[model samples]
Target chain A: MNMSISEIEHEIIEEFGVFENWVDKYDYLIDLGKSIPKINPIYKTDENTISGCQSQVWLHAKCENSVIVFTADSDAIMTKGIVALLIRVLSNQKPEKILDAKLDFIAKIGLEEQLSQTRATGLSSMIKQMKIYAFAFKEKL
Target chain B: MSNKNNIQSLFPILKSSVNNNKLVYLDNAATTQKPNSVIAEINKFYLKENSNIHRGVHHLSQVATKKYENSRLVTQNFINARHSHEIIFTKGTTDSINLLASSFGQLLKKGDEIIISEMEHHSNMVPWQMCCERSGAKLKIIPCNKIGELDLDMFNQLISNKTKIVSVTHISNSLGTINPIRKIIEISHQKNVQVIIDGAQAAAHVKLDMQKLDADFYCFSAHKLYGPTGVGVLYGKENLLNLLPPYQGGGEMIKDVSLLKTTYADLPHKFEAGTPNIAGVIAFKKSLDFITETGLGNIKTHEDKLLDYATEKLNSIKGLKIIGTSSDKSAIISFIIQDIHHYDLGLLLDKMGVAIRTGHHCTQPIMKKFKISGTSRISFAYYNTIEEIDHLILAINKAIKMLS
Candidate 1:
């Protein structure tokens, strides 16, 4: 599936819009989270742990076809769904493109504001961690 | 006075709305809403009387001194302490506990012990923990039960000859367990051990009588009692207070200072050092007046009714598990849904203008005991109406569906 970052984000926005209420949007998210392929256990180490998150979230990436692919998981199901949204938009894209991409969908979806302060901080940390990974992977490419 | 809605009218904050929904503030266990009279009194103090107490002899100073000292008396009468001098003003509940812990550290030897409870707020726990470390004293905890109540049998065994002081909260802030503090104090006294009561949570719900409770030390925050912040009261039996020595060295705490020697000031002043929160102290008197006029009995009856109603309504929701189920509980309901995240529920509720507390609630040990990260807690005060609770019910139902 070859698509630009914006196309994937647009799909997410449309998918979220289909659900008129928060409940169904969450159900969509939960299904999306369950679809995320598990990262290899060897890569899930203390070094990959992102601090400042209320729940434990681990993200792992390896370069393939000059693009960065991220495999991540969260102890919390809701956080997993939130990370899945990030992975859907930024994963399978070039490291430079992932770095340059503006995640407008987060704001458009009202995910940041709708979250509690702690979880919002967690979301922010997750975004920062993914960007750090993309930038590092970009240097290698 | 009997009308709960009339009592709600006294607080101007209730007149406002949040997120276009009339605010249903169920976080009163964290802090109560301030009445209009208390707010006005705070402004009145800064406007007319704004001088330091005890040291100043000028007219405004004398006026401020009288007002400040009079607050001590009001606090003394409020807690039913024997003497006005026994009431010491500190920063807040945490400050009061730290004050006693530090001073009492000096009084303890290597082998002495202190008993606290697992259900205590961090304000009551950490201070004693640090004190134990500094004084080489052992800190013992009375275990909690499945229902969040402390084990009384274990408490009896914990008090011994080497136990210097036993500290416990009159009510658990997170669990809302109204502890049997009177019995705890009696047992401590029998063993010749001093007792400290952390009344930060109980001050609003439980009408305290320091003399009757016979607690050697009682402390609470003014902000939690619907007064201004940065002010707290410490009620100590005079003999225990006098023996503990001055907590801080400053202007008001000293009688006379020489080149190489200094004499400490008398009872209450010895503990209260330097400039105090004059406006906050005066306004606390007004907050007390609100409680006094409404009658603690009326407030208790209304809250007890609200708790029962909220419990039944909350229990009807599928997958909702109430954390603390003590029969002697106050008006707090901490609960967790089977699979819905607490943060998600809290955020969704916030968007709907129904405020509640979520997370560890600064009682991480209690959360650990339950084997859950956190719970959604809705705590009620006298001003919270049934109509407001209905809004909470509506929001919770919405949250459960969305998160599930």
Candidate 2:
């Protein structure tokens, strides 16, 4: 059985709750970044790249059996780690469910600053792009 | 407390903490923290003397105008310009360059050439490209060598009868390589072509004398010199300023307005359009005073020491390579650690309360020449100490270990 978006978010929150210090949290994030499956080189095209990020990020999405799957990569590891966390919750979900996902776990995990407009990380843009893909796929269905 | 501590205390921001650690501000090249005196002046201006300058009979207006003009004079003395009228208040270095490009660019025709270097900031480079696009002029580049220094041989060959003006940065914001402006000015003048020095990075670090350097026009921002933002200075030779057309027309920059023909105001006013940043301009005098009291020679010595100390320590780290190794570099160090991304290092360091700039430092061409996306940069001011550099080194080591 697959977990719902909220369940996965709760699991992430519980996992992050164990770390008392920023260093430990960041170290775990870096480890997660290392473990995340690499995006296929064929999918990393200019059309798939998200702009406004200090570091380049490529995101690709497709719908299979009414479920949307996302594959993404970033040259910067920290950003890639955040992308991995995002992909975990949003990918492999129905288009309507992906569109309605709250994504409150980012703030709950203390990574809210990355979503701020001031931060050049473009985490917010990544989330938006995911939703846009879901919306487009939803129209097709 | 030591003398350095005393100086650091004057900047209240230095006492603040980031992420539960003391702020180790190494981003001085982006902008300097203001001294208490400069901050107080801004408050005083807004609280007491708030009025529009020029063409006012009110007492407050007269006082405001006097203070504003006094700042222009202070700026004149700061850069050792021949006349106060030669100094025009601008929005910032970028604004000043755009103004020059629009006005001076009007003189260019088809087949004329303008020379710039490979290491210019986007502010200095883009304006000329736009100018060339509008006019039928050509843009020529002075190539940079392996060490980030300009190839003077190529520069000489590039300059010819068709070259109208040569504009280059006084110091590379990315590489920190201090270009020999005196030599560049002399070379350009031999061909009877004018030169504009983009002194945005150099103004705070070096002593500038317009008459001594003899550049046709020089530009810089006040925020980098510990003043408020939105204030910049454009120093041009009086004869040259007289020849160029006005950049913008508004209330202050006009002397007479007729239905058909409107005569423009004189030299400085002609260039200064709109009400301007009055409070910023007035408060900038305090920053100039602060620099004057501290002595440029002493500031340079302190910063040079910090640069040398940081360079030696950073080199000891394995897989770390320092870019822009010119012997005549400023207090900025741009470095890349092998297998560690610059953005990751920057994010980790920021978590540790070490603020350093990462990316191309607004010089993308130099990064292309280097064949890298970006490098981490740490720039120093006089208030920064040797201890802070040590903190940075420790943070970098910790960040690298975590990443690896």
Candidate 3:
């Protein structure tokens, strides 16, 4: 099945909307983080580590067949859950689409306003790092 | 304990709510809630006497100078220092300790040693570490046991003629261990070594009688004692303070200024160079007065009851484990639940209106020694009540249920 970034974001927003409370939404997010594809141990070095994060978060991306594939992990479960949400929306998409995508699902999911200032900065850093990867992969092509 | 309600009422912020629920602030070890008296005193100082000290011949300057110097006298008496001039005001405990490190550090020879405890806050550890590096001196650490009590016997063994300074925390911010400071001081004195007590945590819980401990220097942040932030007191023995050079140089700290040469001012001012937090220091006198009126004995009694009650209640929870278990500990209760990340627990509990501190409490060595990432700390104050604690327990239970 093929989906655009907006469609994928809509699906995620709908899933998050199913939860009635913040706790339930958080539980779902944690579960999603648990399911996040493990970043290769070789790529978990400081080189791949994202700065400005409260927790140690490592993201690795590959441009496979002109579509970006993202994998990530974190020492903290909450941060890992957040990274998983990013991976779900941004991974396996074209470099141009990834770079240009609105990805307003973060706001729609109430994360931007809901998160602590520091954590929100961490979230943005992760997104920025992912897009940089997409731009680099596009450059290589 | 009978006037517990009266004591709580003195802090205006205590009446406020968090997330529509009554605020249960158990983060006193981090900082304390200011009494209305202290706040008003600071406000009055800004309104009535807002002039810089020791400069102009104006009336406001004279009044402000009188108030600031009087606060120093109050602090000297509060800490039982022999002379008021010994109390050098600083930005905070970190600034105070850093001052000692730089000033006293210059006196150190190449092969000298500086000793710090394993459970010291980063403020206590980092300054000495930097000083040692700068002076080419050796840095040593005193180890602690499983329950976070410093090993005095080991500490004594580490002391030698080369040991120039033994710096330690009077109370562990993360572990709640009220250190055997007097004994440490006694032993260090045997070696003729100077000891610096980081009283940042203990300044509120314990009465600081400097004469009793006999530490060469003692420093504490005023904010932790319900005074304003950005102001702290560093109390040094008069003779020792005289020997050490000035930490900073500015307007008030100089007696005479010349392009070729300058003469430094006397003690306290020599160390306090720039424009100090004038309002903060003056308001600190009110905080000390608030504590004195409340009576140290009463505060201790109230805090002990809270500690015991919280310990017993949290102990009953099956998966929860208290981190520091020393019998001689103070009013802090640090704990971690099985398989629950402290950040998650802290985040959820914060939403439920319970304000507790999570993470290493700026003591990574203690966390490393305990072999855990961090523990959530719930430190009590005289203003905290049993009902607020009940709210905390309920919030914790809710967090566990949601996360687990």
Highest lDDT: give the candidate number.
Answer: 2
| lDDT for each residue of candidate 2 in B267-374, tens digit (9 for 90 to 100) | 899999899999999999999999999999989999999999999999999999999999998988999999998989998999999999998888888999999989
Q: All models, DockQ values?
A: 0.32, 0.73, 0.41
lDDT of 1 by residue, A1-141 (tens): 679999999988887777776656666776776677887888889888764334567888888999888888875566778888899898899988888888988778867653345443366666777788889988887
**Model 1, runs deviating above 4 Å:** A1-56, A75-78, A93-105, A114-121, A138-141, B258-261
lDDT of model number 3: 0.87
lDDT of 2 by residue, A1-141 (tens): 679999999999999999999999999999888888889999999888875436877899989977998999988888888899999999999999998899999999999877784347767878989999999999999
Q: What TM-score does each of the candidates earn? A: 0.91, 0.98, 0.95
Candidate 3 structure quality by residue, lDDT tens digits, B77-116: 9989999998999999999999999997889979999999
Candidate 2: segments with Cα more than 4 A from true spot: A117-119
Clashing pairs in 3: none
Sort by DockQ, best first. 2, 3, 1
Candidate 1: DockQ? 0.32
Judged by DockQ cut-offs, the docking class of candidate 2 is: medium
In angstroms, give how far residue A118 of model 3 lies from its true place.
3.0
Q: What is the interface RMSD of each candidate, in Å?
A: 2.7, 1.2, 2.5
Query: Top model by TM-score, which number?
Result: 2
